[model samples]
Target: MAYLADTYIRFPIKVRNASGVRIWDLDGKEYIDTFMGIGVLLFGHNHPNVIRAMKEKMERYVHLSNFFLDEDAEYVARRLISETGKGGKVFFTNSGAESIECALKVIEKFRKRNRRKGKIVSFVKNFHGRTLGALRITGFERIRIPFIEHDTEVVFLPYNASEVEVFMKAETVDAVFLEVIHGSGGLNMIPGEVVEVIKFYQKKHNFLLVADEVQSGLGRTGKFYGYQHFDLDPDIVTIAKGIGGGLPLGACLMLGELADIFETGEHGSTFAPNPVALAAGRVILQMITAELLEHVTNIGKAFKEIFSQFGTVRGLGLMRGVELEKRVTKEEFLSEGLLVNIVGEKTIRFLLPLNVSNDELDEIAERFSRVLKV
Candidate 1:
């Protein structure tokens, strides 16, 4: 309902059902889906394991409020910690935006408690979420201009090594939010020099580092956390999108002593840590294991080789953007039955599933070739 609150871009097709990497519309027209509900379904639509986990949880119980305990939460939390090795303590949320909200609060509280300066430095083109705090840190000026939060202090800088080095030298910074691969910003990857600067400065500075892995995490990037590729361990990590396997679940993982700042009454969500979503999360974590990670890396490499013949492929693993030649347009791809998105002017994005088979990947590549040829 983009019109309902002016929240999203409206589409014509009304989806009915899906399995693996294919989706069907109400009239029974089928297409290979890589949009995957904007990257939430990393395991693809109606994944049997995830569905079964949620179903079993539903049969047992659903929401148990924050006051009561849910057994599945422990399993999910443990898995997150083991996967990323950063979630010393985790706060559950309903979406990635909420996870960002929680991370912002944690760092904000940490700064306030220590009497430090309060400024958030984030790169241009990196999107955290839509919540007030997350919105402030979001880099794109188009969407952020009208909804500016007056009280929050945020600094925007170019995603380059020189700019980052200069900014890290500032004492006024409280936290730095980084997205390793610029998902919405035309799938730009961070340069090695910039990654080095951040890694070195992460030690010299006391400012908290928050990795916005909402789109790039959960084995979508061939690594559990995108920042892992940078050799940078963030103080707080926000995860969502694919974590719930299609359900609305997310987490803000805090590490070390920074994990214990919030007192009992400082933060919470009533419906968060829901048993059903946690069950699905547990299953997804299990699904994206060592063997699966290796498969994703190998497949991603092959897809990049194939897509390079079409245009520039500019992202990691399943999170990719195919920059089409001037002859092709996003509208043309949509008309051709390809389900990828047009991000920026020249790029056709691939929000492909993490668990999509090799055959599905080949089919997607073949269709893109068709888009270019026709």
Candidate 2:
């Protein structure tokens, strides 16, 4: 008698507990968690520092209103802005969809105030979020067909289309949304040439570039933000998934002139900047140190080598995908004592934890290889 909505196709196993990159089912079977809570648990499950921070904050207070000043939230916002190395302001949200919603509203307001065009350009197969505004720009038509308005002023371009430069040269655009690494789009990275085209046109037209780093930010791709991997600068960055150490926390970082685009009453969230979540976010941000990023890069390389043996591999850092030669189901992988995310028909997306050690990596490889009989 399940009462939940039919929104998710959940795995069959009932998860009882998790620690680090391991999960134990109700029947007491242990499994390696390569999915890492859909790329949320960067430091892995029940991270000691994150748990401690939340516990301490919970004792003092759990919720705070937007009217009051919040030190924990301020500290997190400052750290996020500093990571981008840009002058910016932050609007906190409870999830990635809310962050995208914030970015969309801000972009619209900024463009309208400046008398710029309202049309936006987004890429095909790149997912922003599930909210109405975010879904309007999301590239998947099947999911968007029901809710998306017919008159939504957005143009969807292929990931590496030359049409971007062609279209921009002819029409003025207000903003361009990009998922530096398309997490839900089978972990496909934005091609380098496409970035060059976007950057060149951006300099001339001065259109706002928004980096949707909801899944690839906060050390998931061995960088603070996935956009940093290339030579592109973004005006607004939306982030979530990893910053709260499994709790709900998302942010829209507005840079330069757009930093102060929002007025006093423009936007607000009731549950955003939750004291407990902010406390956890502060600790998670601090833990994403240079050494941790370096570890992700090196370990990610090793993971690629292992997955490449299975089939074609794509993506960067710990955010990897393997299109295997043979089709395998999630249940089969579960039988092999591994929990991984399956994308489309044949691709397996592996989003390992940032702190996963060499020994743990070896264990995961052994289990994964057994699943494919390699």
Among all candidates shown, the one with the greatest lDDT = 2
Q: Indicate the residue-level lDDT of 346 in model 2.
A: 90
Candidate 1 residues 130-204, lDDT tens each? 777788988888888888935457888887788888877764677889988888888999889988887777677
Off-target runs (Cα >4 Å) in candidate 1 are 1-3, 149-152, 327-329
Model 2 lDDT per residue over 1-374, tens place: 28888898887889999999999999998988988889888888998899999999999988868878778888999999998989999999989999999998988898778988757999988898888888999999988879875745898999765777788778888899999877888888888888998998889888899999898888888898889999679999998988887889999999998888988988999988888989999999889899999999998898888668888989999889888888999888888898888887898888888889989988988888888899
Q: Which stretches of candidate 2 lie over 4 Å from their true place?
A: none
Give the Cα-based TM-score of candidate 1 against the true structure. 0.95
Q: Candidate 1, which ten residues in sequence have the lowest lDDT sum?
A: 327-336
How big is the positional error of residue 84 in model 1, measured in Å on the Cα after superposition? 3.2
Best by TM-score: 2
